[model samples]
Structure formats: C-alpha cells, structure tokens
Target: MYFISTSSPDEYSTKVDRMIGENMDLTRDLEFWMSKLPACLRALPIIYLSIPGSHNSFTSNISGGSIVSLDSPKILQNLEWIYCIRHIMANWTKNQNVAVKEQLKAGIRYFDLRVSAKSRENNLYFCHGMYSCKVEPVLNEISTFLETHSKEVVILDFQHFYGFTQQTHGKLMQMLLKTYGTKLLPYSDHMDHLSLDYMTSQFSYQVITVYRSDAARFGQPLFWPSASFPTPWANTIDHNALFNFLDDKIKDRKDNVGFITQIVLTPTLTDILFNSCTTLEQKLAIDFEDLRTGWISKQTPGRRGVNIVIGDFIDLSDNLFTKTVINLNLKLLRDLPKRMTSPIN
Candidate 1:
C-alpha cells in the first residue's frame, strides 16, 4: 500500500522511503510482514538465497551482503560467530516451539534448551552449535546425539570451517550425497534474505552442511513479482514487469554457454528504486534493480557445460564487484525500504 522513506536527500529517486508505514509505526509493520509465514508454508518449499536488498530505514535491520553476491571482507574471521548466533536463534526458536509442543503431546521430555551463558564461555563463539572453546568435542557430542535421536539434525556450515577451499566445497557436496542418500534439500529459495527456507526443508538428521556463496546485492522491502497482480508497490515503477525488461541476452543458443565477466552498474539505479517513495517498499525495489543490473543472468551454452553457484564470495572474476559486509545486526541497524521485504517468520 504505502512505502516508507528515509531522511536522505535522494529519497525521491531511491524510493527507499517505502520502508515507512501507513501509520508510521515501524514495529507494527515489521510484525505484520513477518506474520504472513504460515500461509507461504502451506505451499511447496524452495531454495532460499538471501542477498542485500534495499534498506528499510523504518525497521531494525540495514540489510546488505547477500548469499548470492559475495562475502564481505569483514567476515574473513567474524562470519562464524554471527552466522552461528543467528542460525541457532532462528532454528531453535522457530522449531523449538513446534518440537516442544509436539513432544509434549507425545509424552517426550527432551525440550530444546537454549545454550545458557554459563554453558557458553564468554568471548567463546559457537558455530552451528559448536563452541569455539570446544569445537571438536562439541561436534562429537552432537554427532552422538544424532546417532541416538530419531529426528534429523542438520549442522550447516556458514563458511566452511574445517577447510572450505573450492576442493572442500566439492568434497562436502559429495559427502552430503553419500551420507543422506543423495539429493539432500540443499536449498529452499534462491535469494531471500529474511527467511529460513534453507534449513526448514531439511527434516532429517542423516547429514550436516556447510554452505557458501555470496548474494550480489541486498535488501528488498516490497518487490512486486511479475506474477503478482493488483500491484503491491502502486506508487512505484514496475521494473519486475518481466516482459518489459526481458531482453534476449542469450537468444536461442541453448548449446552455447557464457560468463558474466562484465556487469554494467547503472548509477541511476538508486534513483530508479526511490522514484516514488522512501519506504521499505521503495528501497527494496531499488535493491532488486541493483541485483538485476549487477548480477543474475543466463548461462552461456558452452562445450564445458555450466556450473551455477548461488554465493559469489567475491574473487570469482572480480571485474566490477562490490566488496561490503552484508549481514544483519538487528539490534544495531535500521531496515531500509526496498522491492522485496524479508520474508515473515
């Protein structure tokens, strides 16, 4: 309906102001958006990849660096801690309630417990459940738990810790297939920063995973998909009007493969995003537009075949890449307006 805007001078062109709400209550808007989770789950599951969308200044998170883009230089050593905290909190909270309720009904007593501060030594970080102070032992313990537990327990690696070279990624993929009987639910949605689609689809304990990739761009507060009608961002330009923007960059060359070594970054992208408002809705649109301009294109039909990767992690050809840390510190940052808002809980 109404997109929010920021106090920035360029709010009109960026449309990031869409983050503002109909009533100017950021918290209410956030809750309202997150509350729509169950309805989406009733349908099928897809791989979820999150990149930095646009900022919804009205909210608590200033999103950036997405899984589809590239990992920021800041995360050289810090990613482990941030990802661990987020993954546990999200996974535990979201599933804990369901697990506890179901177990209580079934007469089970093993409620999921939060890692007490006492249990977790100060300054000692835990990645996907492994405390830095006790990585090997903790992993062993979890491995033991998996052996005894009936349900599946997935241990996802944010940045391959035990060795994540290109070689390691391949090895890990192979191991997952061998351990889980092939075709593990590796992804949920392609590029959604605010949802848990990646982990939720995994309802088993036969395997664990370490995911890698970079989201080229980030943030999206209000993205009117090509399929959605009546238009969500009524006051904004419909760049996602797929047909209008669709150009045959690859034509009908199904037999030839190509590489996106060059990306024409349009400086006008910010203006396009906020063409109308400065709400989360507007910033999100701009972020999406940036993502489209900077990355995400067709594969060239080539003799060697194509290998599609979700995360960019930078270093891939490095022609015109944005090197910025794009994670959400919900407490420290404010959300911006954009085309696609983070998914609801």
Candidate 2:
C-alpha cells in the first residue's frame, strides 16, 4: 500500500527548494492513495468523497510562445522568453505543468478541463484563453489511468467551452460518448450506499462527467449541469482573500451538490508586471504549509466534508497538496465502517 508521511513539512519544503534550483520533478510517481483505501470508505458516495484536482490542468504545456500564434516571428518568441515577460505571462497562463497521467498517479482524481475547437477540421483542444494540447490524447491518458486503476474513480469536469459553434459542442459530446462509452457514470438522484458501492467496485465502470453546455448533454444522464457542481471563480490576487472567499462558499455550500474548493491565486495586472520575478511554483511553495495546517486541516469537520479541492501546481513539491487532500480522505476512512454500512440517502 502507498504510505505518505504527514509528520514532516520538510519533505515538501526540500523538494520545492530543489525544484527551483534544478529541474521540477512534479510528476514523480507516488502511491495510489485512492486504490489503497479500506473497503468501507471506498463504498461512500463520491460527491462526499475528498478529491484533489487541478485548475486549468491541461495548461501545464502552455508557455508564452505557445500561447502566441505559430505565425509569430523568431524575434518575438525570443523576446517573450525573457525572464520578466515569461514570469508575467506565467501569471495569466500555466497553472500546471505535470501531464494528466502523472497527476493520476499522484492521487488527483478530478480534472478541471477547458475545451475549444481549433478549426473546420473539428479538432478539439484544451484551452484557457489561449489553447494548449489537443483534447483526445489527454482523454486517452485518463482512459489509460482508469484501465490500470480500476478501484479508483475520477471526475471529468468540462467547465469552460470556447471557440465552438453549437454544432461543435454536439460533435465534442459525441466524441466523448464514443471514446468513454459505458465507462461514464450516469447521474444519480440519490448517492445511496448501493449506488456508491456499485460505482467504486473493481468490476464496475467509473467516471463522473460534469459538462457545462446543454447542447452537449444529448439527453444523457451522465452529463451534469454547472449548478449541480459549484466551482467558484478565484478572481483575486490576495492569496488570503482567495482562501477566505472559498471558505465563505464552503461554509454556505449545499449538501446535495458537489463543491470544488479552488485553491489558487488570480494575479492582477499589477501582480503580473510588478511581481514578475516570482513563479507560480514559488508562490505555491510559500503558501503550502499555511494552507495545509490552516485551511485544509480545518475543512474536514465542516458539513460539506470537502468534496473536490483543486489548486494550481498540484504536482508541485512532489504532490504535497495532493497528498494532503488524499490524506484528508484517508482520515475519513476510520469512521467509514459505521457510515458505509448504514443506509445513506
């Protein structure tokens, strides 16, 4: 079984310091925490389950030059790569850098995907203002992860759609249905004990798809509306305020719907230009300990019980925050023997 030592912050601190000095090995494989859960805890409703996710998960590949058009000249590309501009550009773009499969291994069960169609060729790509890699390959990676880790379930939330005609949305939905097929879980009115157990069983299929557009729903029960999944926007530069905003939402959240605690800082124009030297990695590193002890640790006792906790740089510092969230789930397991056996509606 996978074991995570929660006793020391130094393990993460040292890793982050090394990353800044050398290569960033955020994708280094770790133990599969979800699959290691006790049987009773595994039987709980996924909406009540604690899940770690990435905000703009597909944007790890986005750089300043990549966000710009391919037609741009070499000179422009070179200038954009300069330290200040790159850091500034990093603010708006590049929330994550680790690939999807790596994130899966690191115990991230939820993926916050933004999709866009590129051209008449009908190619769909992952996007956040500007585009990144194509969508299908990433989905393929997720599929591969699911295949290997049958006991583990994942949440695919297509929260944003851009550069798409109405027809494109339908096409995208068709593509997803075809690709995922029966593996996708249909919507359930009540996340009772039986349904939860069935969904998480090794023999049963898994995937909770939350699609933003109604055009793409295709009357399929698998697709959930935005209202059922609340992913509050983090439009603030103040790190503390961002957490406070999420804290307020968490306090007021409805038990029926799933919640996404977006732990990220949205840098304003001033933060971008003035604080150009600091990378997203550095910011996350600085805030990591405080967030773990002050924010995430305090969340387990709340009514909602922390559904999906998303953040930028999930794979950073060797999956520090991801492990923290997963450990929170593990912490829930001790009480599960009683809860799981009881008839939960």
Candidate 3:
C-alpha cells in the first residue's frame, strides 16, 4: 500500500530482541524459579519436599593417590591376581565424576562426604576406601558456590571417618567451624520446619553439617547425629535387590529426620572381575536411564516421592539422572500454592 514503509534494520532488530525476552522459557531454568518461589511455599517443611543429592560427592578425582593398594610381597605384586585387584580398585573406588561445584550447579542440594586422615600427608582427605582431594579445597569450592547462589541450601554429611583418632576428629571440627562459621546451621529439634527461604534469610548461605561420630561432637553445637539423618547404604551387586531396597526405604518417611535412598548400583569383587572391560559409567548408564524413565516416574501422586535419592556418577555426560532427580521436586512445586493455604497437621 502507499502508507506501508519498512522500518530501519536496527529498529527491526530491537523489536525481535524484545519479543524473545518477553517469551523466554523460564521453566527450563530450575535454579532461577526455585530462587523465586513464593515465601509461603518456601515456609513448608523441607521433609515434605523431594531434595536432590549426590552420593560420595567428592570422589571426582579418585585415581593415583586415591587408589587402594595392598602392601604385599614383590612376588605377589607381579601376579595377575594383583593386577586384577588393582583394576577392581579403579572401578570400585570411583563413585562420582562430578566435582562439588558442578554438582551444586546441577541442583544437588545434599552431599554425602566421608573424610579420613591421610597417613602420608598431614591433612584431611575425602575417602571412599581410598583418599581423594584434601578437605579444605572442596569446602572452599562449596563456599564459593554458596556465595554465588545465596538462595540455595546444602547439607554436608560427614557420615564416615577412617584412620582418624579423637584428636583428629576435634581438629577436623575446628577446621570446619573456622571455614563455615555462621553459615553452618545449628543443630535443631525442628528440622521439618527449616525452609530454604528461612535458612537463607537467617544465614546468608546455610550449610547443615551432619557429623556421624560422637567424638566429633565435642562442644560442637552444629554437629548432628547419624540418627537424625539416616542414609541406609545398599551394598549389593544385584540391581533388582537395590531397587527393592530403595522402594521400601522411600515408603518409610520420618517427620524430622532426613532420609537418603541410594540409587546407584553397588559392584562387589565378583562384579569387577567379570565386568572389568566395562567402566563404571558404561555399566550405570543403562540402569540409570531405566530407573529414571520407568521406576522414578511411577513414584508420584500417592507417595511423597523421594526425600533424597543419591547416586554415583551424578553428573553424567547428559545430566539426565540429575535432571530426573530435580524434576521430582517440581511436582511438589505444582501444589505449593494450594498446600500453603491448607492447615498444618
């Protein structure tokens, strides 16, 4: 028509940019929406929600120094038996491939940390049979992540300690307190009511420390007992048995106590020798996919879903397992507004 004139290139570009921003798919960004969840919804008990977690979260670098090797005779070391055992150690020792920072970004809010005193070095190391990185660097990485994501909360469960004396435990506690200080959430009887919003509001970056040993609790008000947070480990080689155990565990939910359902398949000595050609990643990929697609989906509606479902290799290549775990929590978010208005039992 006579009145129709094309706009300038810059003007057209600006219009397109505005349209894209307005129609942005925010649902894809879990962390952004999680941070912006309504205060009323945030006030709900944490136990009622599905929390994403990682098992043996600090074993990303399990090799070399972390390898579990037996001090044997030179003759024994040269035998094929010794070689097989070394290969087994490589497979069994590595439980995770994602470091702390990467796991945090993938919506992992709970971390199962096992620390041990290294005989060769005068430092605390994260141990899953063998030792990995020093405790301080991992703590620093977590601290840095918390600094950036102030709205998030993380649980640091020191559930196991090897080669540590009472004094060593005390020293570790001192280091922890010194590092986290006020960010560490004090031990409380009312764990259910501890909402993410409340925690972040109270402490800038909240970290709930669960200490397993009684010796580590000396004068440390922040240390929580193993009873308060129970993570029943499935030490079985059978995938069917593992699923059955996790299913039964999920059904039995406690009020104030934190529960963990271990989702990863445990490989015994026999598994390693038989499946030596296959890596841990390769072995778990198919099982993880099946569980995410088949078993996990059927857990909604009647059940509260899972409290915390942890696994090995949490940060898989595609992060499919981690996303599945996070999506479990989204189902609760769907009913947040309705639940927020309902009466508390």
Candidate 4:
C-alpha cells in the first residue's frame, strides 16, 4: 500500500471508511470500473485518475498484406515489396492482440490512435509500420460501447497522422464530430477542475478527443490540442532505462495537463534485424513483464503522478497489466482531500 507522504493516518482511515461504505470493488467490476468508483474518487479531477491504455491501439488488424504506411521508416517502406519483409514489419508493428471493443471491455480507457489517409481513397486508416483497417468502423465500435456504458469515460488520442492535407484533416474532424456529437468533452484551460462527476453527471460528456495537429486549432472545440496531453515517449529498449525515464518524467510532470507514461520499448534497427523472426511481444515486451508489472504496482495517481499508463499487447498475462493500473486508483482514497480543492465546473 503506497501512500503519499502528505497523507495523515486519520485522514487515510476516514477515506478508507468512505470507500468501504460505498462498496467499491474494482476487480469485480472491471468492465464498468469507472461507474463503480467511490464518489470521492469520481469528484477528483480526471487528470488525477489512473487509466489503462494500449500503445498503437489499432494495430491488431495490421498484417503482411496491408500497405506499408507513409509514416514507417524508409527502409521498411522500400522493402515492403518483399512478402517476408512485410511479415517481419507486421510482427513488429502489431502491438495490441485484440480489437477496440474488446479492449474497452477489458478496462482500457485511453486509445493511442495513429491514422493515415490512403492515396486515392476517401476513408482513413489506422497505421503503425503498416496500415490497418478503416478508421470509421473502429470509431463506431467505441461509440457503441459508450452508448451502453454511459458512466464510463474514454480518451481518444489521435497522436500521429500521415500523408494528410488540410482538406483531409477537415474531413476527419467532421467524421469525429458526427460520430460522437455531444458526447465529446469540450477543451478547457482549467483541466484540473474537470472531473468524472463534472463531465458525466452534469454534461453527459464521455469522450475526450485529443487531436495532435495544427488543424485542431482551427477546428471545433471538441478536438483538444496536443499540449493538453503531453505524451513523452521513453524510446529505449533497455528495461532499466525505461524505468528511469518514467520516474523522471513523473517527477517533472507539468501542471493542469494530462500526462501519458508510455511503458512500451522501441527496438533499435540492429535489434530488430537480429530478431526479425520473432514478434515484438516475444522479443521485447514479454522479457520485461516482471519489471513492468512491478513498476505499475508501485505507482500512485495524483496531479503530478501517473495518469494514463499505456503498454504493448495489453491483453497478455491474463489482462494483469490493465488490472494493476486500474487498482492504483484505490491509493487515491487515502489522499482525497488534497484533490477535492476548488474543482472547476
């Protein structure tokens, strides 16, 4: 049980009493965990909440036959003509094992969406090293989930875009607005004041769409800018380096903004070439499972603490990765008073 240094024993006990009285069971209600959160926890700013996310979230559909996306490295793009090379790229690029709807059911609230506009095509597609399925169907899946699970909130982070003109950006923005309508939470400068209770209960807003592009500035208020959610990548293959990078980032987290700790590792070209026959999960992610789980178990959520923690192949290890991140919210009960100050309407 990790407690914040500022928490007093009396305050901790009182908070625990409230939580027990509310009968909050995170493990039992993994599908609708946010709806089951204690009132004290729900009242805290959303930035202070613990959320589980997947890196390259839509890559599950990527395969050897898929077109190599423009955002991939030139080497991969050039050699994509070869079937074996494409297969290798597919293995390394595909991060999530399940679809978006399944991920939502397994307690993942944040989505790392990297999209690209296919040449001569009107539809948008999600991409990593290679392109995946069309984007609209996936968005429909998420929208359907939120329709039934009204109490749950989800963060749709459009982190990267490839081969898109100004017109294409507009088309995508329109699609988003049409799909979610009033469900999208409008951006606010006072992010610390926005909580699950404030958005869901008062406004019925359940989606936070983060579009990382200059186009977002000229688009609708529903599309939040990237600065509101600064997701700094660790960009390291070594587990020790990744751990240190996460610790340092958390210590220097900016005020009044959402932060994402990307727990996935990036393999160097040499490592990728040497392990071409193996998938990124077997060659890298699985090897660091123990260290990753240990680090997540020790995290706490707060204004400057862990917020959105993302990983690769999140469905692995019997969904323990998502479960551990969700349970971190229980720690906030001990320090609820610190977060209950002057929440913005």
Candidate 5:
C-alpha cells in the first residue's frame, strides 16, 4: 500500500518540477553525483548503494528504417514487413529517449543492454523491438564517459543476446575487452566486500560488465556472470502488480550481489494495438509517472532495499527518474555511524 499518491500525471510532473527547482543545488551536480557522494556511503558495498539505470539504454536512435530484431515477439517480426506496422513497433519498442553519453551525464550508472548480432553482418546492435545503433559506438561512449569521471563506477548489464554464435560471443567479448581494457572490474566471489572506495581508489576499476551467458563463466573474469547481478523482470503492465512484484523481489533480494528493480510497465499486444497512435512513453511512462515516483521516494538503499532502479524514458521531467534513484543513497547517511562500526560482511 505504498502507492498512496493519486495525483494526475500533469500534477505530478508539476510537483516534480517544483521539487527540482527547490533543490537546484542537488540536481545541478547530477552529472558527477557519484563522484560527489559522501565518503561514508562510498565505503559501503556497491550492492548496498542505490544506483540509477535505464531500461533498453540504447533505443533512442531506433527509427522507421530499423529492422525488427529476432529477439522481438514472433508476431512482431512477421508483421514488420508492413510499412506502417514497423513504425508502430518502433514507437512501442523504444524505451529510452536519450543517448548513452547523455544517460551517463544524467547520473545513470547501470545500463540494461540487450544486444543482437545482425544476420550476415559482423557488427552487433542493441535492440528492443527494432535494431538500434551499433554496439561499438555505444560502448565507446561509455568508455569515454568513464575516462573523464574518475571516481564514478558504471554497471553494464548485458541482459540479453540473440542470434549470436560461439564465435560471435567471442567477437563481442573481444570488443568489450578492447573498449574497456583496464577499466573493467573483474568478477570476484566477494562482491559484497567491494565498495566505491575500494573499486576506484584501491583498484581504479570503473566498469563492471555483466554478461548473461555461460560463455562468461569461462571467458575473461571481467565478464561477470548473470548470477552476479540478479535482475528479475516483473513483466506486467498493471501498476499495482508491478509494485507488489517489486516489494516481493526486494524482500527476497540476496546479499552480496546486485539487484535490479525494473520500474517499468510492459505493454500488452492488445494495449499496443488499441493505442497504436500513442507511443509507449505517452501511453505507459507518462501515465505511470506519479505512482513510479511515489514508489521510488519511499524506497531506501541497502542489502534488502533497492540496489539499481531502472525505468523507461529516463529523461522525463528533467531527469527526475535518475535523480530520485541517486538521492535514495542519501538515506544511508542516517546510519553512517552504525555502519562504520559494523563489519562489511
């Protein structure tokens, strides 16, 4: 029953705007917020820190020309031959509205990347329903961001892969190794012992690459296996159901690993077919703004609380989604004294 706010989307947006206006000091530094976090909080395990992320982090460039990805529903793929249907698919499939660099600058530390290898093509691409920009350029963008932001850490979650062979996975993994090089944090059994301070100061590790395949197990230690970051999808469009699902997931979250709470609504075929004229942002993201914020504001950051909270259209209301998630870490400050005395394990 945490969702008590009954405000309309416009009313909630206005309220958020006012809140941001009032807290200009905090919002202004979002570009480097991680680097500016209180030292005590930085010393805590990253699993216990609240981080901001984006769902489908590379769909900003998907357009009418983009092809329906193999990972999309079979029905979507079959009907994509129709011109208008492809555009409609793009409308519903695009989950993010900004580029990777912009997301990084907006304090998004976790990136939910779903990659796919194009048939007869050597390059890999990010996709939801339609293929987005090539993966290399986006990876370059993240590496560039990390170069300038020395103390900041980013989690690159390779959530899904499609049409990739063993050789293709090798190519993609090589691309990652070349792009990140020494910046990557190798997988460790004691992830709970890793803190921002330990990562940045002790080892200078800035990027944690999570690959969700068995290939990651035998490959470079830099490619963390899916078990390291347990991201369970609620896969529901109902707001109440999404909230309840998150509550259970958070309560059951395991220690010593990253947990992702996808604060998003999945559109059903019927919902999309009935509202073909509207974009997912309009039909789902904007409509759920009030409830999403209400739920986010009430959450805290810890082993059993929200670790990484991701959402669609993260640039909405002046990057309100990222700001709200990042601000949750401030709650940890209240228990700084007690935490300092306690053992990290």
Candidate 6:
C-alpha cells in the first residue's frame, strides 16, 4: 500500500495522460481507490496504506510462514504493482529525464523480472536461478546514475538478485561512492530471504538491507487453495519461529554490517492494512483458493503470488540500532537442517 513513487513530475504527467487515455476520471475514483487500500489486522500491529505515507507510520515486523495467503497469489495489490511497472516501462521508453528513466528501469528489471522466485529455501536465504542473464551492466548504470544525482542514495537491494555484496554489485556501489563523493545508500530488504553473511564484517552493510520484503511483500494474505499442481500447495508458511530465527541471524550480523528492514503482509491482510481502497480491498477478499485447487490440467493454475513489492530506495532517519550479530545465522545453519529434523516444523 505504501508506494514510494519517486517518479518525477514528468512521470506524473505520463500517468495522468494514461488515465485520460483510459477514459477514467481520477476524481471519480478517488474514494474508490482509497477504499481498496489494505486495512491493518486487529490482532497484529500491521500497517496498511490508505494513502501515501500511511504505511510509514507503522513499524515493521517480519512475518515468517504466513505469506500472502496462498489463495490470491496475485501479489498484494497486483494491479497496483503492475500499474507501477507499466508506468515505469512507459517512461523507460522516452522520458526527458533519461537518467531517472534508466534508473527506474534498472530498478524494474532488478525487482520485477529478476527476483521472481525470491525465497529462503533453507540456510541459503536467497537464490537467483531466475536471472539467467548477468546484471552487471544494469548495476553499472545505476551506480553511475546514483553517483551523478541522488544525494543519500539507498540501494535497497530487495533480495531481488542473489548477493548484493556479490563482486559485481559490491563493485558498482564502490565505484559510485568512490567516483563521486556521494555515500552509498544502504541496502534494505529481507536478510533472512538472502545470503549476505559471506561478505566481510562491514561489507554486507554497503551491499544489503534488512528484510522488509517478507512483511511488505509476503507476510500478509492473498488467496489460495488446499491442494494443486506440481505441488499440492502454493504458499508454504509464514510464522514467528522462522522469523525469530531469521531476525536473530540478522541481529547477530548487525555488528559487522549495517542494514535496513522492511515489512511483509498478505493481500487480504494488506487490504485490511491500508484501508485506502475499500472496494478493491473487499474484492480481493474473494476466495481465490477455493476457485483454483487441484491439477493444472486446464483446471488449476499456479497463482502468481506476491513476489516483490519495491519501495523508494531512500533513507528514513540516520539513527538506527547498532546490534552485533552475536548469534550469526550463517554459522548455525546446516545443509538441509529440516531434512535432519524429519518433518520441518
């Protein structure tokens, strides 16, 4: 719900033009859209954005197993995310601000197309088979852009790719900060959902942000069924024990590295959070799971779950917790720990 649209005024004009082209009136649908925003669940301190900045008001917490209810599969507010993507794609073609457009496109390429299957399978945290192509050039372009323009640039590498500190990504940030005097913006996304501990003590800070994707992207609910295709289920689990362990790993690693955190929530859960768009929120509540359960033999199809929801890669405040990752997660993890434990809890 909290869309950190840093798109310039030109982007706005483009969007408005699209609205006009669609023959839809923004004023007429103002309240309608507002109503579609998510509402915070009563039980938890979940944050929903009825309007811009509303989400900023709510603090973030990691939701482990209960990812966007596997039912909807449509990323939380899929239409909105898609809209933003299309908007960026539209601008990526021919915007006056070439730098901004390119940067935005790089972001889209990284978050939208690259990090589709982002998830923590075991101890690895993050994986990247999804991106068969190298992202080096994109990183170079982004670094150059940041070095030239952004003030306190925040990378916010949302577990979108594999390792932010991976040589390619690390060097890009270094080039930017080193080439220009601008300090590299810290990366902030999901720590548990990524494998960043391989870097040196301070290296991860420059490369990775804490995991907020799980909360902002996955923690909440959407819609899904009991059994289905290649796998009977869609969503696995989003719970506290897993989050607690992941948080501990992140906390333990805090000493050597600096990081930013994000939030996660499901679709229906997100609808309840923002409370911005009432009708859409309600419409999303429909049982998408009930509708699609069983084999994909023209009957059931995999739900396009909320894979990623990116935010403006900008800093909020300077003051932050400086905890030493006393209990390093990487060290404790066993290759397929769950396999040794019989049935994973």
Q: Which candidate is the best by TM-score?
A: 4
Q: Whose lDDT is greatest here?
A: 4
> Considering summed lDDT, which 10 consecutive residues are worst modelled in model 3?
336-345
Residue range 1-345, candidate 4, lDDT tens digits: 223232577755665666655554575777898998776678778898999999999999888898899898888788889999899888888998999988999999999999999878888999998999899999999999999998899999999999999988999998999999999999886698788989898888999999999988964788899889888898989888989999999999986889999999999878889999999989988877878999999999996799999999898888889998988888876665466543212
Candidate models: Cα lDDT each: 0.25, 0.67, 0.67, 0.87, 0.84, 0.23
RMSD of each: 20.0, 9.6, 10.3, 3.7, 8.3, 22.6
- Model 4: residues with Cα > 4 Å off, grouped in runs: 1-25, 341-345
lDDT (Cα, tens digit) per residue for candidate 2, span 146-198: 78877777888998787677877878877778777888877765554323457
Report the C-alpha lDDT of model 3 over 1-345, residue by residue, as the tens digit.
011122665654454354335434323654543465444445655655556678888877876434452222344334525555555555666788878877777777888988877657788888775557789888988887777778877889888887788889888888888888888888876676577776887556478889999885567788788877778777886767877887777677566677777777777657767787776777764556665445665554213347667777766646666666555544543443334432212
Q: In terms of TM-score, which candidate is stronger, 3 or 4?
A: 4
lDDT of 2: 0.67
How far is 310's C-alpha from truth in model 2 (Å)?
A: 0.4
Better model by lDDT: candidate 5 vs candidate 6: 5
- Tens digits of per-residue lDDT, candidate 1, 1-345, equal 112343655754344233222223212222122122222221111111111111110111112211111121334235534653333222211211122222222222111111111122222122212221222233344344444443333323333233234444344334334444431333322322212233333343233232333210122111111111101121223444432222222232122221111121122334533432233232433345346434343322121211111121121222111111111111111222222233222
Candidate 4: what lDDT? 0.87
Q: What is the lDDT of residue 180 in candidate 4?
A: 95
| TM-score of structure candidate 5 | 0.90
Error of 3 at 293 (Å): 4.4
Q: What TM-score against the true fold does each predicted structure earn?
A: 0.21, 0.79, 0.81, 0.93, 0.90, 0.23
Residue-by-residue lDDT tens digits, candidate 6, 1-345 = 112132576664464344334433212222122121111111101111001111111011111111221112244324423443323222211111112233232222112112222234211121111112223343454455444332112233332334333443444334334533323222332222122111212232222122323332332122111110011111112334323433343333222122222221133334334543332212321222122111111110001211112222211111000000111111111212221112111
Q: Which runs in model 6 stand beyond 4 Å of their true positions?
A: 1-127, 132-134, 155-236, 250-256, 260-345
**Model 6, C-alpha of 2: deviation from truth (Å):** 33
Candidate 2 C-alpha RMSD relative to the actual structure: 9.6
